[model samples]
Target chain A: MKDLTTENITENVHAINSQCQNPRTRYIFERLVSHLHDFARETRLSTDEWMTGLDFLTDVGTISTDLRREMILLSDTLGLSALVDSIDHPRTGKSTEGTVLGPFHTHDAKEVENGYAIHKDPDGTPLLVLCTVKDTEGNPLGGVQIDVWEGDSHGNYDVQYPERDGPDGRGILFSEQDGTFWFKAVKPVSYPIPMDGPVFNMLQMLGRHPNRPGHVHFLLRKDSFDPLITALYPRGDPYESSDPVFGVKESLIVDLSEVTDPEMAKKYDVKEGTSLLTYDFVLVSTRETLKLRKEKAEEAIKKMGRSMEDFQGLPILDVD
Target chain B: MKDLTTENITENVHAINSQCQNPRTRYIFERLVSHLHDFARETRLSTDEWMTGLDFLTDVGTISTDLRREMILLSDTLGLSALVDSIDHPRTGKSTEGTVLGPFHTHDAKEVENGYAIHKDPDGTPLLVLCTVKDTEGNPLGGVQIDVWEGDSHGNYDVQYPERDGPDGRGILFSEQDGTFWFKAVKPVSYPIPMDGPVFNMLQMLGRHPNRPGHVHFLLRKDSFDPLITALYPRGDPYESSDPVFGVKESLIVDLSEVTDPEMAKKYDVKEGTSLLTYDFVLVSTRETLKLRKEKAEEAIKKMGRSMEDFQGLPILDVD
Candidate 1:
């Protein structure tokens, strides 16, 4: 006798736990049902507004492609992406913080030596980035691979271009034994998200700006430290104060200092007028012994009845 | 300085109200962003779990076509469909209760006189349904149009069949001077929702049944009273106690009484083996004067910038 009452809706939908083998999956959906129903009731949402929401989600799917993921964009715009990231990689303050793995991350980007330029299209002013990778106690963590990507001066990712073949303004750089890595790229600029679709239409209708402030994406890895996915925003864009995606962290912001010295330019192998961005990544202690983490992740995977082979490359906490 | 922190995610996304031209839209989305983020944090949703959700929604879109609206089904499965309907059409206990206007409703149903049969391609026992339409005070509301539709004995709507055209097990009937009508249709059989897509996949994973108990869909209209959309569930079906969509209303459930008298069957033009389904629809008083409602709906539509012509047949709340 559930008569479509808001009071009973959440309870009824949450009763689907009769056979879910995965406790985690059931837990997630139970909360999802509760929260979604609560949101509708709290807002006293109208029929037309609910229809609009469905239509908006449909449009998000319609506009998604290999280059653009409207779902990620939607998650980012609404801060759900960042919120989930924060939950998984909680702020222990003992490690380099993690950020959202935006839809732009792809595999097999051209690996370059330290101090190489990733700005292939050359759409922005030249800049030299100098970064240091270290363990929690400030010891240099040498030979770690750092995969980096960012928007160009015009605030566009290489994949955003229709004619793109390989990654541009994106690279994988191996840090020196001294835990220092430097590279060349364009100055970051804030840009609007794709507004031609339904997500943006809703955003526009909501009186919200669709701009994401500029930043460089870094995916760092060593045998021990958990993969530290972080981003560095240029210190002072208007969007820095109000990033549409809530991506900016005060600790992650790096100031751009103008360096006119020719000697410094030669040492860094960059133009004399290049701006310098110096930041350091501090890795957290892998508290659980590497073997222990692997064993746990493997056991969890097996318990879920999924074969390891099918879950390859699925962030299994490598010990190598 | 929002570095994917859970604390600021809600605030950051809720800031999308700067440009929303529609006040109501902004209010709705602001609440949506808040609850979605809170849910992720409360559940500590894993990255893979979030990705699964995105994939699920994407599949929902991929499976949806002109005929199939998996999004609505997803909403229904989650109880969102029932929740929103209840919000819009609250139960005042004065009129016939409404239920989920399931995705099967269509236009251009064959119009028939009283006592006409709606079951065109019957696969089970035939039945005669006698229905009366009236106002809340029990006065006959004659000459109103009542569109009745239901799944056949197989629990399949005509729209679900690719080879079907027009409507079967569905018809539009006008109430006589006594506000009474009757139609012929097969007995409703409980059926599972389509399980070929991600929605049903998740349902199975959660160990939840996808069956919607047997019921008939009715949409009635008149010039004075507000249009009423309702559903009638057959009593004694196991799913009646646990409709997957939470659509069963106690006030809407009716039992089919056995008809044993031979003389009455012949007078009603029904066979001896036929069952009888008798129910009455009581319309609510159009509390607001007719002219006031029409003017308000029209004014609101115009203010929203949609032309009256484009929104014709869009529930103008006419009083004429």
Candidate 2:
């Protein structure tokens, strides 16, 4: 029968929620309630302000659809998506770093062979993408699966155009015996995140831009290896540094240099001066990934001033 | 061009948001981002977990409509609504404390004279409500407008029954010259919050019961007095202690006793065993409310390790 003041309501909430049967759910909710209460208290959040926030969240949810996920966009703009990705997929032993899987990705990208051009139209600038997959020891690994997708030169994904018939600027390819895969696609251009939603409204209110850096998304997987979800931001995109989603990383940014050699163009069957993006991905085995994650979990537990036992029932990326 | 590791992302987010022109928006966002990132890092929130939360929020929003406000229900269940109410309307002196003005309040309550019965049917136990309003010095506050509403004996508000026409169990009344008011209404019974939404689903997951204590809502207003939005829970309700919305306070709980006096029941136009609930409300002037809020803001800022300058542009309830 405890009365709830602003000071004691947090603990009251925790005590009430402690009846949850799942330990991980309880622990996550405990921290979440603590931070939520702390945020309200620290800001001395007004009733009006609280209502405003709730309304914004509701609007974000209402505006979301299959083609547009405003909730994920909200997370991205607030940096939670990036934080989760960073924490979940920490780089280990020269492995490729992962970034947020932005909502634009679709599961139905067209599959193509090596040296195939994914673009069906000539509206976008020609770009030659050359990628290689290797182990942490720099040994080429053949037959790895690569899923690549990017916005067109005009900064719109195929999904953004309801009139478009099929996927464009995206393809699935398997690494050749030399651990190399080449594909010709449009050069991605910096694009504003969807503007007709509460996320963009929030960004405008915060004096922040909604544009993400020009980038290509890559999803790589192989047997017994940790999958890589990453993006390569073109080096000179204006929004590179202040990517609204915070998905950019130093190692993931790549230079797009022009290849003016007519011999190279003839060999690739493309026009001269086509841009070339060359990058090699280093993959980490599942065992190494597990070790790194365990170490990270321990470090995080120590930093949180909590024993590992407090997180006992929580999953630690149990890929097995 | 800072790399957004889990460690540096919080500050990077703050830096990017610093371009906000409004100091208050900037400050609020700074704290929000800090806590959001902290929650993610401390919990090591996974991508799947993040997506689950977003989906839950989306469902909550989708379930809401004009008659139902699941967002406010979310705030209430999470204790944020109560927290904000306590912060906004702290009790000063002997003034009555405020609680959440829940989403069921409608503006179209029928105006009635004191002692008028708000119920259109005879379906519940009769109750006589006697109320008086006074200032801090105990001076009677005549001509005060009091808006009162409550759930029926079946534990459903008028709004919850779509087929029911107009407002019942609710009325607007003005105090007599002696600052006294009386009314005949159904004795409110404990009721579950709307159970068809994500909030209820969350409560179920958290092992919580969704019932609120039997209560009546009062909204008091006058020319210079701070408007009071509060509710009175009947004593001895089983759910009083753990109101799902955390709206119950010891001071707000009232004694409801059976009154068997035939003369009294006849006078109040009710049965012999009608319950009687008598409570007095103390109102704080708008000036006092502002002063109290300003002091609270200062205390909160100090506790937040921030100076008053950081909150300079924010409104402090300037009723004038």
Candidate 3:
């Protein structure tokens, strides 16, 4: 056996792991090992530094629970989540862009009706969220399910509070016959991510802030259309320029106008001068999304000098 | 702020972290983010795949304890530990090559004398460990401390058993006036790494076996001399060519000759036909090790287009 040196270690690792039964898995790990080895070599990473990194990772995992996923938080702050989302959900022509689902999302949110109040108690400025669901051809789509969630004025999600009896600042609602959806909820305020976790420590080490911009997360689904996981950042939030998670996209940033008209407040069942966030979401059909993604996957496979026949069993897109 | 995309996310992540006060940390993270993002792009990493990776990492951290470090196991299986050790401890002249310190080394080993029997119970083939400590110039160096440990015939260490126990198959000894040391210990048997952890699951996914070759760990230290942490693999072990941790080195592999002479067996206080393994360890002075490491560090910094002055605060080498 050839002695493992810095120069041969990378290839040796690859060769050892080259026998993975799944082509997709083997491909992913092959690239991962290559980049990981290159990173170590380029940095000439010291043993102490490596130990410190492992300690940080352990802390992150230790602090994680079913309610909070710190591993996802780590991926977010490192810009990895954003990059993956952008790659997997590349924008179709005029389609709404996708972003991270974030660690705060929960499947137990209450299903409410259009114009229903999602916030349990008034803890911040009253707001009206108005959205329209449309197709790539700008045609209205009814019966679309839109899940909305955000942190309260105190910058805490319902899950963050141990005494949370029910979901607050979050709810699931459907579009009306006109493809228009409106609801009453509190405006999302900029807040720091959980500071007790290792991700916060990493941000501190980087001399970066730990706050995500004020934004309302939305997960939209409809029959025959691609599901969109996204968030709408309020324009001009203090942390907008420096969202540590890098979840903000230019297209996802929308204006939060304060409507002083009493008539408008009465119509939306909110106090006068409440903030208003309105945007139209365009979603692509599953057929179009799958085609595009499959093409991209094939391109990637070709780039690696592999044949599509070898990876036919792998799911290129989760959508079907 | 520029919207993060696959093409620009790397630089944007770097820019967000550019304010790090420590130059060394900034440099390391700069390379890390660059490579991490490149890997994601190269793989076109999917969200599901990313989530799977995160889950694996969480499992690794969750299974770790003060007694067992799955993170180090993961690093070792990936050949990262071996690469770092090779880079950090390059051989100088005839000085013995260093390998991974491994996670098995403990600070609580009992100190004994030359020709002492370190094993608690006779459970395997009788063997005599004979070694001489010398300087790089080939001069004998007395009073050098050598810490030795290995698994028993059952392929398990003392720590692997939860039952109450003291140190077994491990001890600390010093070279005598003539720079020669000998000890009686059980022959090491090839063993798989802990197979109950996520690392083992990963190995299975990679279609790779987990066994490391039969080897005994040795850590040698003397005042003013650079410490050596390495292992001697018995020649002809079945797993030598494919050690999962990549810890084997050609120079560190040695033969185990059977000594059948009754007189020699009596001299070493072992049974007739005991196995004899002998070698000399050459150590470099701390001054020389530091000099070589600093030169390499400087060259690495220059390669990154950085100046050594910017990282003077960072400890380049653990050795003084």
User: Please, what is the whole-model Cα lDDT of each candidate in the order they appear?
Assistant: 0.74, 0.84, 0.82
Candidate 3 accuracy as lDDT: 0.82
Give the CA lDDT, 0 to 100, for residue B303 in model 1: 52
Report, to 2 decimal places, the DockQ of model 1.
0.36
Chain B: TM-scores of all predictions: 0.84, 0.91, 0.90
Candidate 2 residue-wise lDDT, A1-320, digit = tens:
35788898998998999899877788789888999998888777877788899888888878777767788888988889988888777687488888988888777887789888777666888889888999999899999999998888778888788797778878899998888888898888899998877888899998888889888899998999988889888888888888999899888999888778898888778788889998999988978776776677778867876766434423332212
Clashing pairs for model 3 are none
Model 2 misses residue B242 by how many Å? 2.0
TM-score, prediction 3: 0.91
Span of ten consecutive residues with least summed lDDT in model 2 chain A: A311-320
Q: What DockQ does each listed candidate score?
A: 0.36, 0.63, 0.54
- Residue A137 Cα positional deviation in candidate 2, in Å, after optimal superposition: 2.3
Lowest lDDT sum, 10 consecutive residues, model 3 chain B, at B311-320
DockQ for the candidate 3 complex? 0.54
Candidate 2 segments whose C-alpha is farther than 4 A from its true place: A110-112, A115-122, A162-166, A259-269, A310-320, B107-112, B162-166, B258-267, B310-320
TM-score-based ranking, best first?
2, 3, 1
Q: Arrange candidates by lDDT, highest first: which order?
A: 2, 3, 1
